[model samples]
Target: MSKVAIVGVVGRTNAGKSTLVNRLVGEKVSIVSPVEQTTRNTVRGIVADPRGQLVLLDTPGLHKAVGTLGTLLNRMARRSAAGTDITCVVFDASQEPQLEDVGWMQRVAKEAPDRVVFVLNKCDAKPFFSSMFREAWKEASTTPQPSPVKPVWVDCCALTDDGAKGVMDALFDFAQEGEPLFPEDVVTDYPRKLAIADTVREKFLSKLHQELPHELGVRVKEIAEGNGRWAVAVDVLVNRPSQKPIVIGRSAQTIKGARKAAEKELSEVFGVKVSLELWVKVEPNWMKNPKILEEMGYMGAVI
Candidate 1:
């Protein structure tokens, strides 16, 4: 018999949960960016090892709710953590524990999941606050619960393969004998439209940096697939008219660059020639718009 488990990767925003998932899955299953709330949807990354398989749920990092979208992301992260065979809580050990980290600890402590793993990511950084996180976990676990939950703690860098090996080992160790959820060759089961949108959004995030990242949204409206090519029509949503030009860049360089980069990555990801038609639309408060959120797959159930 083979081992299998659904592992939920949860943590604060920008805490390297996506990076660790990508590393563990040995592919880019989720978009990685320094910008907060980079991952808005729950992506499933399938890891097939000699021992068995692991279905990783790469969820949106929990952050303070600022609006409808922000609150949704936090809710998504918390919901993902429930009902999983293993709850993997990733922490940025390079920095001290934040409010979200403590919140996760308290939740785990109170709920008392059967299996849990506490990943201290960024262990390579100088002045790693591993002890602080342990102390925080201790404080959180002191709260009375129905049953005591003991979490396997592992240090991970997430930037290199060797750094994330411990996390993979710990997860497999907790897995039980069962059949694989996905095929051995498949790396991820993320939806095609959402995956393409995430790739396009990642390019824009790289170019835009900190300027209005949270305000930016990418939604793929249509995809025309041919014998060996795909023409994707995407709507890039901005909150205000003033931010539209910023996403478009000077003389349309920004949008052009983002499209080109996204095409290249999408082509590689889908193993076909991918082209993107990006339309920047200024929709006031698109984040709060229910229809827009559904179109972007934020309102949909996680697969």
Candidate 2:
């Protein structure tokens, strides 16, 4: 019988969720950034192993939400947790897991207890783990509501290729012997348009630091065929006018450089020539507006 595993990779912002997915798939399917909350939605990567096919669902980092966008991202992460066959709770090893991690687990414990796996990521850095496991067990035993089952612990590093393959091996054990979930050759399920949008967003995250990453959003407004190429227009939304100058950089050189880099990646992903147009506009605290958040593909009940 064939086997398929729906594995949810989740963690706090900058916890290497996307990096781990890319490492597992042996490709840059998900965009990686040093900034927090780089991933705004669920990024799926399909790993075709000899034993079974594992569908990896890389979700946005779980954190406190002060706005509609934050809430939507949290919902997406939780939703992936509920539906997965195995949940990989990725925690940064550089620091102890915070109270929020415990809380995240408590919520998941109520749903699929046994399907969870506590992954201590970034092991190459300083090693500090929250006694999250002990605390989680205590909470599970004491809680009045029935829990699914207890999860296992798998520690590894997404960078430097440390222990990542072992983590993949551990994840494969959770798959059910059923039909393949996706085509064997497919590495990622993201559409070309969405993928381009992600590339633009990633370039922004990697280039911008501090609050800039969180304040920015990207939308592909147009994609048209040119002479043997595709002409693309993208809108980069921000919350303030002051931020525009910084993103545009001195003489618009920085933004121009970012645009060129984004275009090259888009061309590779779509296998066609890409012409990119970038525009900056103020959305006026779009993160806080529920309606705006929904319009940006941040939906309800993702968890």
Candidate number with greatest TM-score:
1
Kindly report which residue pairs in candidate 2 clash with one another.
79-303, 113-149, 114-149
User: What is the clash count for each candidate, in the order shown?
Assistant: 0, 3
Q: How far is candidate 1 from the true structure (C-alpha RMSD, Å)?
A: 1.1
Residues 23-101, candidate 2, lDDT per residue (tens digit)?
Answer: 9988889999888788887888998878888888889898888687887788788788777788888877677656667
List the lowest-lDDT window of 10 residues for candidate 2: 294-303
lDDT for residue 81 in candidate 1, whole number 0-100? 93
The 0-to-1 C-alpha lDDT of every candidate, in the order given, reads: 0.93, 0.79
Model 2 / residue 174 / CA error / Å: 1.1
